[model samples]
Target chain A: MTDPNKPASVARRTISTPLILTAILIALALIALASGSRPFNQTVIDIFLRVILVVGLYIFIGNSGVMSFGHIGFTCLGGYAAAWLTMPPMMKQTLLPGLPNWLMQLQLPYWAGALIAALWAALWAAVFGKILLRLSGIAASIATFAMLAMINTIYSNWESVTAATSSVVGIPIVRTIWPYLIAAILSVFIAWAHAISRAGLALRAARDEPTAAAASGVDITKERLIAFVISGAVMGMGGALFAHSIGVVTPDTFYLTLTFTSLSMLVVGGIGSLSGAVLGVVILSSLIQALRWLEAGVTVGSTTFGIPNGLQEITLGIVMIVILAFRPSGIMANSELIWPRARPEKPDEMSGTTPTQQGVTK
Target chain B: MQTLFDALSLGSLYALGALGIALIFGVMRLVNFAHGDVISFSVFALLWPSTDAVALVFAGDLPWFLLIPFVLLMGAGLSVLCELIIFRRFRGANPATMMIASFALGFVIRYFLLMLFSSRPKSISLLPALSQPVEILGARIPLLQVITIVATIAILFALTAFLKRTRFGLEMRAAAENFTMARMLGVRANRVIMGAFALSGALAAAIGLILASQTGTADIQMGGAVMLMAFIATVIGGLGSLPGAVLAGFLLGAASVVMQTLLPIDARPFRDAFVYGAVILVLIFRPQGLIAAPGTKERV
Candidate 1:
């Protein structure tokens, strides 16, 4: 009962790692802030978006122990909201002919649009999540993916509301470093806060053991609802930043490719940890850009490096397969690396079934 | 009338797609997101040889019968390969992981197909005679629609017979009920699962061929929208219940077509919303799925 030395040793190991990592990250951020070339600026913002996507994704995937195919739907809502609100009235009239008189009359500031967009996405999530949140594992995932497909179809075809054509325009361009930096910081903070909260504990319980959690009176549905809403809000805000960052939105933009790319970042960095989300975003986004360079018909010295024009996707697929095979748990697995505390095993651990899994699957 | 015909034909395709979806879900409990791509993959197979080699069957010179089996085999092979590589290992994973893997697999498959096919839309001409319109009670319907309906019924009939009478079919049904138990009882569950995937793939391929002929073009994105519809059909039909899927498939098809016919021109675009909305309502009322397995703490 009196293992004072061991306790102090464990504390030292846990407390020091985060301080080192944060210091390193801040240094890297400073370098990014003062980077050169157009690609460098784009890279910073790309990391920011990935940060939002990855951390938000982890909340659902890590907490409830399910993958969501429908997170893309919220991203679409976020993009469209920003696109609709920030579109200048005069410019929107020119681009989107015969826009509703009511729509044309309303105007919003850039930040307000971002906030509203986040709220709108969160609101949608609340309605959708109420039904969707309760389903775990594959059922939840399929439903989410279904939502994405259905919403994308609606967005692509609902010409009056979203544009008839796939292409959209009239976003104010703000291609700079601030948005990405702020997004990354906020996203990290959210992840940190989420991991430590009471709801987070119940979600972890649900992830590991639904029956036990249910027995303890943890309302699994409510936990999922909270995660879904908060995650949607974060993704929505990121979309707002992206709309202004990229200065355009398309139906295709928030579809599978975006979903896959975002998911890939989380996969590469690791799935279970906050640092993994941040680190994975940075590493994977840079790698994608690097891969593009390798394939971009370029020559350095007497050597030329270029893959088949369409090989980029194939390469990424290969990497994903390898990762799944070699490290089914992404880099961080489901455990965080910093400010460390005792983490519990997911209730629905893959190797064996609990009473609920047996009950449901049977 | 033309719009109504188009909607009916499209809904018929959705039902066919849904049948394949239900079979896979019923048996494996995997969402099989790749189901739609199997159809897409078959379309390319049917269209490519005809497009690339003018001498190939269905290039307006060769006999149509020779090409039919080729298309069918392509469907069968693609389904088998997908089953072997992806869905096999994923058994017993959280349904969420399985679903994501499927979604990922579907993405990779479509993009890879796109890279191979250069993302162009393709079509197959089954029969020029089948292209001409037939007048039906004030509705001018293409002969292809009639052929599609007939083909769907014929295939379903054949599948039903196969499932009931064949040794392999019995094994498949048994395995679907309980994989571990069936295996312990000496069923070669792997072989049975593969067979289910193969048969389902064939249905999708055949549907893809017939419907692509009607719609006049095909593309990669086509798989996903239809996959969701098939998912609805499967859900409505009941998980692991074959008859349930078929019943819901045909009913949903007819309902969607009727709804589209009644809708205003502008609202016609939103007909899918009505179908999916209806599915959600159905699901709320029947959470176990329309035709659920009757057991507690056990699957069929």
Candidate 2:
């Protein structure tokens, strides 16, 4: 619910920044749509889609300063939702012979199907977040972690519904630079808008100082629930975008490794701010891509000193450790990486608590 | 009949692991989420081949004497190492960071073990006496089950004494209850926390070895399943309460067994599911946990 008292100053502030950003994003999207499988174009699309995930993570993680080891679960939920919904009905029938009669009857187009999948992800999160969002710290984490494990096991074995959930082969190849590009821009928009929204402010308040937020009459539970659900829903949309792009979906893609990848992005990029999320995704995604290029690129002379793809994991792990040890606040900290001229303000009540308050302590 | 008994033994082992996790979370208030992997490291310490004659003196087909001490020592050492390295640094961070760290560290240790021990589950041999069945109430229960039950009782007794009787344990309790006050009173805070971590690690390792010996396989991923059980147990019992974890562990174990009994053959896959469901049920109704510290937190 939008606050009845919409601080009037926010409206008069500026349309130029939002318009300029939207314009730049549209141009980039057009370029992506025009380019067909160009190497750099692929990279550009990939970077933005990942930003969607970082931004999704930033919603709760940045505001709350809590670390979640299970955001990959949300991403996985999203990917599976999109892939399953968008499949050709005939292929869906053949692949999921055991799919219930109702699902077999419905055949939707890619975009509509993606929307449905995102809704499903949001719905699942709404159900789970009711229980999850109330508890702070480790209890919340453990509950969420349990959720991840249970879902993983269920999906791993619930083959009939998930096309052998372990593997979903033969997805219709509809992914392109455009979808990823759109998702990236949309993701940033949603993320930026959310941080300034009432729920976002309340969630941030609870995160910064639960005691103060609660004392000041912010419904911490409601704020967290909203953030948790929205975050999951956006990640789901990103996953749908990713599935359409990749043309295939597998449980392996959603394992602890991917979880580590996205998390490393959040950590290295910084967890407290939107710009950090964007920078983390762009920098880390490019780092991995550059490493891949290096591996495939020729040696300077006779001897090669190229790093192996497997070593990327080592690099990522090392980066997380270094970031935690040194600049855990992130380069942008809580600030956005690309800034608009003017900024937003908060309601009368915001807490001074650090990540320690909102974080999963156990 | 013996399989029925084996479940109880397994339950005891689960209880021990839960106790370990519960203790650390209770005291330092961090999840000690790497607990399962820490147990795995200790299991490797035991299963690691040793050529010395003294190694045989403890387990060389000699009987149960060496095995118990060896397991305990391995557990203690691994626990101490975890404290000094990963855990000690994350003391002041929020529960979220510590937990994320634990989850990450667990993976790191698991992968490292995968490199060393191969992900394959390995087993060790024990005495015929331990393996052989003992007839009880028309059901043949394995002697190992009896041993586990006895040992669990013994360990609990010793643990209670250590925590309730000894000054160090009191200091540890004080630190857990009120850190600043304890520190103001001249209690060495770091030393006590380190002790708690070491003890937690030791307990987890011992249980890990027992699990491997019973289940006939030691795998890098083994700790996670059990760790989840421990987490469930700790939550069911109470977040920072030891007795709660123990009670929850036994309840979870028994419930799983009974649940399997009630499950239709096809639904058995969801026995663990039901266990997790139970945890969720408990958590929703009682957020402070089954037996939270009196007056610690009261939600408005």
Candidate 3:
């Protein structure tokens, strides 16, 4: 068992995991840049944005062992916040006439808009988390999902403010990949920092051994709230970047499709480990890109053949099911990817208690 | 009178859906997110696969008696296939894993439908006779609405009697209460589970048929909104309580209809927001649900 009191070794291992993961991300970005294809660069940017979202998911889900379906609501909030702040004044006036005079008049830089978006998302997380974190297990999961539905419903129908289901465009488009790459790296570091923090360790301890942790005076709800707020902020930043990347924000975009995609990536990678979060994104995003290329058409000598449209999603679903059926704990299981020499002596200790064991014991 | 009838009719759909979800969750602790896709798949099974704008009706054109059973069988068949191929392997997996697997299964089913029919909603008129309005106690309502409410009540009673009096139903209830214990006592685990899946799938089909006939359209996503409401109903009712699931489903349906009628036209579109907000508040007050079942409580 990994002891929270053993800070020295835990801290050392934590630093290495984030460093190795960040290096891999940087290497992939460099390769994508070297490819010299605009579409490929866009794909790389998408992968980075996904990285931030999945890693943000990891901070709460991996540590707290709670499956939250509402975090994407924060992304919805963040995306709209970015769009509200960054869209030109004239466009905002016509598209979102419900905006107050100051917001209607103001247009901020991307970074500033993302900052406000993050804060806005975190604010809601704190409020919702206070009420939601009290419920544990399936109840908590359902509550979070309800929260998402509420957010989506409001955004989808509040016509003047959110443009009600229609896409709100005219935000500046960001084609460059560097900003996304940096944001992803920053998200990874933040997740790593949270994982090694007192609250994260307490939350994990509570997750793995709730009765014992509670006996030892761990406030499970408080730790969960902390993780929730931090993850909400990270998800918010990713959402803001997503708005800039696509040059449009819509309620449905942040609804079920995005929620499930980010979640599937996180779970397929390994829900319990940060390395799994990052690797899951890289592998799955690459698979999707490759599939899309085939769907567009693949050349064999002179003749061209293309996979039928919509086969990509079907294939992706099958792949995910196959993976989960075989490796229930996910590809990385619970262990972080580190240099072989840096791996701990006891493998089980590094991975902590597998979720299955915890499940059975509970 | 009109509002009361509308609420009952809408409630019938949700109640059926909640029952399907609750049954599976009781036995396996798995929240089958694919239940929605099962609904969609059953509806699409009525039409031949085509990219054309107009749906080519196949089984949908059958007489009402045959049509109902055909759709139910399709739902049961697909659901059973899913159990054999996918869910059976996840028997001992954690809840999160099982949930995600089911979700992936739903995704595959949904995309399969999308690929076949394209995303466009297909219009199909089924049981045109039932669409005509009938006066009942000074209120005018469609005959199909009356049938829906009556069918729901009949099914609920039949299910109740089956569980109370039949051997297989007894075994199912036993397994649901305590699967390992029931298994040790010689209940065939696989049989019981497969039966639950079959029943749940049939329920999904029933909902699909009603929705397809009432809306006069065979949209790929027709089942999604109802499924969501049903899932929430299952949660608010009690994880493993059948009666509670039914009751909560009705309550949710009534809540939705009431919101639709009472809210001003400007606020009508935001009705779902209020309903979901109420869901959060209910969860806060009753985390274990309104009627807690024996095995659902968390010790720690």
Candidate 4:
């Protein structure tokens, strides 16, 4: 393991990746702010939230090369933690009487609550990842899912504390897109930072050539755990903002549908690239919104036409299948979106170098 | 006696579901998430599409002999069609991509059903005669329960015989064991894979029929819980092992029933938490599963 700081190549590689990511975030934020309509603003907020969640997913699934079905468990935890911290004291006393005196009485501002939520979610991720990361491949996937099921079951049935299956209301709503925009930008930077770190390079190496990487002294488990915890924290923050957006939190909100939707965005974009994660959310979210508008009916000169309800989902599914069938590695195919270079190089070379290690040797 | 009967009945459903999942997984490493939707689709096929709470029985009105075969064929046809249209293109994709594709396909099927049936649970009295209780040794059980168990065993034995005695079965087994080698050996890859899909589809239909008869309702989500249990069974039994899947399915079903019956009344709602906890423990201890199939080891 060479020092990341010693190489000029590593510094150049690190700068470009984050620069590209920050540029994209700025473009999205500008568009969100430029849009005047409340509905459009809300839509942007949703997309930004999704971007955070998917980017969080990329930290682990991308680098570690493991598909997790359980990251939603962290989201659930974050949502609840935010709810507990931000909900009105009176309402908490009535709705969730089982909370300890401090939690029952405490009422924090949204930013503070969200920060606490992220830490709370990350703490649990560390514990669960410690146990589950030992198993690799499909077995790890199932274990994560089981963890999600466990979280869902307890949240759904713990009536006195979590309001069981019922929605917990009275959390302060933040309709302004700026907070979400900032959070989304922060999340992307965090993801970029992790992806450029020495740990990220080692994790990717382990994912691609586990036996070789292990023989070379990479601690695969530790690398995976680090990615998992970082991803978990990002997901938690996304979940907290999600609660603020909707002003309500239910266990079901953070369950299978959310999990699959985020996973699909990540895969459709290019599961292996940070640029893919951002673009995937932007593209898919736009497509869904467009379809939804069509479902609401579109006027064509003389008459109005509309797709029947439910066709949107079917269309989305077909689109996903077609995309996967055509480009199985995803839209980006493990390559970052880079500015056009003066000299063209081999595709393998571009994709092979870690985003952080791109020019270190040169 | 009652408790044993209860466990067996539940186990029979799970075993059947696991067998369907295992068969497909053996041939292709796909975990076919759409299987639950296929079960829902089969039951919905019996009724004329309607939004009413009371189902308008269409093919369901036919004699049991005709109705059963028709439903089975529908399931098999749809399953085969999915393979041809969707799974065929994903044959060479990574397992994660294929799994997501299958999940997307399931979402399509579910929403399609939702559009037709309006998401309401529809009641249909199929094989109402099976609803009666009869003496089984010292334990009285619903005729449907007894039929479910017996039918499961019969299917298992028949499938075992088919896999052992037939040329097609031998090809499928060989393909499952080592697809590339089997293909090189001149087993027609398409035919063997199609056969697995067809059989898996028919089994889904069987579970659908049994569920429709016992529960007396055809809800869009009826198959979800069963499909999830079957999926877990497939994993814990051994990813590509047929007998392992069936065994694990029964074990899981038995665990669920026993937990339900034995847990304190106040703790009853948390029964699933305990079951999932047990699942985590099992996975931690036996990551390769209770029965590790040959050549399925993780590369690292």
Candidate 5:
């Protein structure tokens, strides 16, 4: 989606960012596969899922410079959708008896279920986005959060169809993780393609300079709605995979905890940078894994070393604050993972004078 | 009539929370995610640190006079302490950074409480006398309910007067309206911000006391639902508008109570969905909020 007028070298560098990210993810997946350890594999899978979510979040929030508190709600929707489509007919008939007769009778392969889940979530995102995209800044964020709360409330109380607050079990757990890797990769490409697309550019323009963007004939709300639906689709796919990973779907699972976790990762990584989105997940997930290991105890020579059980969360919070204090824009600071030396030689790019490069530098 | 009182009491609680949020946002662009944790902390301060099922009453045993000030002071002190330690460094950072930072700070407060008190909801029979039934017109209400309504009105009047009549209140209002301009015009930024935090913290404490009395329990997560509703109210009221926040808070509370009463029994559990749906509608129709605070429109 890079503009055709852009010089070949710059385009290559822009393309390298996603390629590099994909390579890194592939390497991690291969490492997990090689280890053949279930826990480590699960840990890697968890990180991949987060990458998809944060990347999905970045598609809208990073580009639009709008903070969203509702993407997780779409994940909840997708999880239930996946559960509805993939669960054995017997289980659905017995547990979710209020499901329509056709839905109760039907079951699909995991991929088909995930695909449908993505569409189902995206379809609703369009519905909700039609209303929410009209607002911008903090008001928009709040509206999204309200949407999430509404979804959570309905899902939690709609007993027969959703199993209400109880976890819907029997999702075919895809423990092997290849599917998650593919999905995560898909999310990255989608985010990358959207970021460079005309809509993404206009949305970023509106974000950085709403007045100027509007003066230039950009339909800010329409552009924002586009990002909203795309990001919604990505979040829905991630949510489906999340359900399959755990073989359970519950409304609360897609509430504040996951919302904050992904948002924290996105912010700590850098809100405006794609590399930041992916790296945030990788770095934070690694830190969490390390903390878990310490909590379980580690041997140092003849003695065991361990932190208190609750210390991990405290440390994580403290680390987030410390990081934000030092690097307010995030670790990436709106920069991508392009070739490090490419900028110095390209004086124009180094100065970040070009309109296209403004997002990168800012 | 009972339903109306119920609505008013709930609205008052939300209004207080929104006021706390609005005060800080008026001075700084921060949404103060930690405000909820502060509420939980204030209530927890009354009890001796314990992981046991039963609370060990400490300051909680104080007569209402001393106890009230103690909890309020705890809230103010903690709010001020957070400002001094954490928020002070984030003065000019972007809104997203500050919001996330506040959230992280709240996370720390919540987990810290968890470490000391455990996640168990502790029971504390606060102001047992307030639980007695009282007559008001045709309505039989808890004395606490009436007290809550009266106390909220009193606080609102006092706040309005303070803002309207005092030099410091004038400075605070100016800062809320325009921080940089106020600072340029001789309002001390640090003092005004700190004052806002103190007032906000005290308000959180009031909420803590109210919640503790109403539920007869103190839970780590108790502040969450109210905090979310208050947050919504704050936004729909207009981000930095004090009176707007209060009015929206009350409206949301009423809407919630009414939905609970009017919805069919099967739909009653989905009351919050209806309320939130209404919130989205309000935002869509009037994104600047029910009362748009001047100069709040995004500049960039």
Candidate 6:
């Protein structure tokens, strides 16, 4: 019934999607390794963090058809947890005296702290998702945003514990790129695995056709909550790594700007596809780095010229708008990157055009 | 008594902001995140382009009559321009896409302002006469507070009359209720949306003027807090319901003032956390909001 040149089957994609993404990531890591420039290495690490965060975002938002403005709140929790666990006991004694005696005395390896941070964020996600997953559409989005604002307010004002708005220093920074690279790869695998799981299928079913899926005995709320908790864990891990990537953590760092950045990246990458999430970060991060270089001054012959100080952000905003205007579903339009040689004439079946592009506003 | 006045004045500001946001959401499902940026832009319109600590008051020096309309017109003009340039292309796009686009637009506006007038907060005396205290009944209130409350009520009354008595208002209300149906019934979609933008922008301008007068400073970030609170109000009131939004805005203001007055000193700093917690609880309990407008319910 199918042509020889048709898109690969679901089985082929199951193995191939992650493989292709992993190869791309490895290629990026290899390039960073070859370059050996400190700033460029740092930039790659930043991109890796975004990869983890955006992929984490895709786990819930991609499958559920719900936009959450609060996942970065998990990143905040994970970052603070990393700070509390990894900061030197002597520094904790002076800066965060309000922490419990055991917590104050505890100093953790970055890996252990990251693991605990994941669980910590997961626990809170479960709690919030239980209450929030019942709402649908825009109201749900607002509730999640409220959750983020609450976390921000509490963290910003909890001076004795969080040092208020002041940055908490002494988070052991990991300058090596391996840990972040591994974490980014791990997040992508987790996302791919979840996408193939039964719950993920059910959640996606609910997203595309809520009435039919509900009629077929899908517990929409439970499936959504499951995705919520898993994504929360991924976000938590990303947050801890984010703290380690920088030697300091502040509540402000995880607030609106980061929220919009990750969301924009995910949305721009193609909110519905896993490959889109990974590639979105890579492409946008590279563009941003290039813009920064240009901002610093690009040398052409003997002349050096640079953009205005704030034009990077302005231009980025314009670029995002143009991208969205031209392709509302994003650059990938919700389809993964398959083998170019075996391109499907009818498009890939599993993650074809998302339900969003089909004109289902709700 | 002073507490009540404070609550009312604050409530009036939120009400105006909610009204502005509600107007646009009613026409299109878009939640116009740039409304706050427009507020900031309107205030900055009064100042010359400079990054200095001292604000070079330009249009701000005009008589109060001209100054007020000038700021309002700036807000309206900017808002309409955004609708034409950016949002017009996004007609019938998914809500998430539109929301992100609006946010991106706001980012561009905020950064543009940052380029023109650095991140530093600039202080300017706006309508200095409004600073005087007037004794009303037993409590002395700032004249501006009384004016704010009265002006809000007048605006509400006029808006109600327009919506009820005029052809344009009727068309707008119909579009808000159901855009497709209204269009089929001969209402022009772009016209209604543009009108909504203009009115929303003017309300943002009004809030800008009031905020500038109250704070005596124009900071790039000044509109952010008010915008967030007003956004919450718009949702709490119900997305498409005008009266509901105004009512919810006033209620939110009262709750905020009451909490600030009643919370213990140590817990005062966490007031926003408590407020946000209450918001979460409200959404959980009334996902349809306190007042659900007709036709907004999803079809099963």
Poorest 10 consecutive residues by lDDT, candidate 4 chain A: A353-362
| Interface C-alpha root-mean-square deviation, candidates in order | 3.8, 3.3, 1.0, 0.9, 1.2, 0.8
Model 1 chain B: ten consecutive residues of lowest lDDT: B51-60
RMSD of 2: 5.6
- For model 2 the interface RMSD, in Å, equals 3.3
TM-score of 3: 0.97
Candidate 5 segments exceeding 4 Å error: A1-5, A9-11, A348-354, A357-362
DockQ metric for all predictions? 0.29, 0.20, 0.83, 0.82, 0.81, 0.82
RMSD values for the candidates in order, in angstroms, are 5.3, 5.6, 2.5, 2.1, 1.9, 3.1
Per-residue lDDT of B133-174 in model 3, one digit per residue for the tens?
999998889999999999999999999998889999999899
Chain B TM-score against the true chain B, each candidate: 0.87, 0.89, 0.98, 0.98, 0.98, 0.98
**Residue-by-residue lDDT tens digits, candidate 3, A238-314:** 99999999999989999988989999999999899999999999999999999999999999999999999889989
> lDDT (0-100) at residue B16 of candidate 1?
77
Per residue, candidate 5 scores C-alpha lDDT tens digits across B49-120 of: 889888998888889999899999999999999999999999999999999999999999999899989999
lDDT of 1 by residue, A71-185 (tens): 8788889988898888888877766655678777667877888889999999999999987765554345556766776677688788766775457777888876776666656
lDDT by residue for model 5 over A1-362, one digit each (tens)?
Answer: 24456565334557778888999999999999999999999999999999999999999999899899999999999999999999999999878999999998889999999999999999999999998888888988999999999999999989999999998999999988799999999999999888777787778887777877787778988999999999999999999999999999989999999999999999999999999999999988999899999999999999999987678898999999999999998998877887676677665452122357354224
| Chain A: TM-score in each model | 0.84, 0.84, 0.94, 0.94, 0.95, 0.93
Expressed as tens digits, the lDDT of each residue in B1-300 for candidate 2 is: 555665576677778888898778766777766788887777666555432222222242444677666766777777777677766776676554566566656666666666555555655554445667788988877667787878887888899999999999899788777777889999997788888877887788677766666665556677877887887778777777878778778877888888878789877876666767776777777777788864246444
Angstrom error of the Cα, residue A5, model 2: value is 13
Cα lDDT of all candidates, in order?
0.69, 0.68, 0.90, 0.89, 0.91, 0.90
RMSD value for candidate 6: 3.1
TM-score of each: 0.85, 0.83, 0.97, 0.97, 0.97, 0.96
Write one digit per residue (lDDT tens) for candidate 1, span B1-300.
Answer: 666556556656766777787677756777777787788887677544332322133332346686667767888899999878877767665443455566666667776777666665654355567789899888878888877777777877888898889988888777777777789999887788888888888888887677666666667666766666777777667666777777777777777778867889987887766666666556656656667743212221
Clashes of each: 18, 12, 0, 2, 0, 0
lDDT score for residue A292 of model 6: 96
